[model samples]
Target: MGESGAGPGTVRPGGRTARVRAAVLQAAGDLLAERGFDGLDLAEVARRAEVGRTTVYRRWGNPSALAADLLSDMADQSLPRTETGSLDGDLLANARLVQRTLADPRQGRLFCALIAAAECDERTAGALHRFYRTRIAEWAPCVEQAEERGEVPPGTDHAEVVRAVSAPLYYRFLVSGDPVDVPAADRAARAAAAAARAGAFTR
Candidate 1:
């Protein structure tokens, strides 16, 4: 299906690739949200994307791979980092976004299911790891800005600070069945900011 000299024309090589990727990702996401990881079928995704089965298989390979790309797409489309000019402000924004996503019924369950699946599947784990890496990197810049503003100590490990911001949300997502509301977002933000203020992110 994909080997018939498609010339990647149908896929737009670059632009088309992005377009088709978006379509496939959107379809895959809908399936994931509706069906969970186990229910996502590549064939259905191909049909929905109006792309060839070969294209779907050759491009993404498997359900886990598709799920990985789906997450990647979501991260790419996520809102740009907020620049609040203060440690608490920036951290709260990050925390709030994360909490809101995880607090959503479908998104939260999908993530929990994906993480659990990743624990036993290497391919899924790799994708999930890359997704988290992208997310953490996306939000790391706020911490760097904070350091430049003297809100936190110099040489703060921005990535760690970002990770800290997400720790509680992830904890709540995985450890407990508690609702990750606005207050939880605030707590995570404040806790991470406090730790960074005390040099937890230094080094």
Candidate 2:
């Protein structure tokens, strides 16, 4: 909703407005990584962003709305999926990307914080779900292409295969406390590919 100035959750226009939004979101991310959602104060974000408090308040209303906008911005700016000509290769690329993001010091903590926020906040949870949907949709075509090549059966749940590639990596990131390493990523991709080959993802 924070893409225009039409309502309480609206973002701003381009040029200076876009710059302001970028700064605010960056600050929000940094704060979330550092102090988490409970510590996300509008005034602090405004101070960190060097924007007026009124601007932050008017544009994003509250911390939940600001976090939602931050998630939306992340989705909009995320890189497109890699196409590797095969389901395994494409899923490996997807798995590697997710692993890298989860292993990054700042990004890992930021994601953990956002996920924690989502557990107790409806708006943040919706935004988090939307963010994953965008990312999954970007990668779903890889499975569709695999289906075209008969690597997987028809009516396969392309999105589910994509999710399967990342699920283990996220488990390492958010739960098991294990290393989210390249080897783990490779295993995840391979496992998902094997599952899809067996029609585990078929509708």
Candidate 3:
């Protein structure tokens, strides 16, 4: 929540231990963006965070695990699902959030780096998948709300629907290398919205 260059002093106390953990997690994210999965050094991370290296190793065990935790933390901090009184609007909002996240100067490259690293690392891949699941779960209710409003079929897969809105953006990032611009986001949202209406995402 603090600026990128903010000191470790911004850490607050829900409890002393919790504050230290939070500082370590935030620092991990910054470091991951600055360096990368392969570039990550646990000792260096601990030193920069002003936390103990032993504690870091004991807690997360390794760089990949630390990346997972950092990503999971980011999902928790993501904006709540937008309910704009219309299914199309809600889906578009979700798409736009994805677009914005992938377009961030540092976070964008950070994600690309993580995804590439996960390709050969099963543990990292599973952890990254779980992170996506968390984000999808957070937004699933919007789809459910749509079903209740008769905007989507009753059997529509809410999680899948939310995931659909993001699939194209990731495809572009990972495969297509196409622009994740506003127009692309809008198209992804509209496509997902239409598909859901027609039961494409329904089980």
- Output the number of the lDDT-best candidate: 2
Alpha carbon deviation, residue 132, candidate 2 (Å): 0.6
- Candidate order by decreasing lDDT: 2, 3, 1
Weakest 10 consecutive residues of candidate 1 by summed lDDT = 1-10
Q: What is the lDDT of residue 12 in candidate 1?
A: 34
Segments of candidate 2 deviating more than 4 angstroms:
1-13
Q: Distance from true position, residue 106, model 3, in Å?
A: 1.9
- The TM-scores, one per candidate, come to 0.83, 0.93, 0.87
Point out the higher-scoring one by TM-score: 1 or 3.
Answer: 3
In angstroms, give how far residue 188 of model 1 lies from its true place.
0.8
Query: lDDT by residue for model 1 over 1-203, one digit each (tens)?
Result: 00011111123336877788867876776677677778889999889888889999999898988877766555555567778889899888888888877777666666776777788778878877877787777778888888988988998999998888888877777888677788988998999999999998789
Q: Give the alpha carbon lDDT tens digit for every residue of 1-203 in model 2.
A: 01111112134567888888888988898899899899999999999989999999999999999999988888877778789899989999888888888887777888888899999999999999998888888889999999999999999999999889889988888889999999999999999999999999999
Error of 3 at 66 (Å): 1.3
lDDT of 3 by residue, 138-191 (tens): 788898999999999889999888878888998987798899888998999999
Model 1 regions lying over 4 Å from their true place = 1-17
Better structure of 1 and 3 per lDDT:
3
lDDT at position 156, candidate 3: 94
Candidate 2 residue pairs that clash:
2-10, 2-11, 3-11
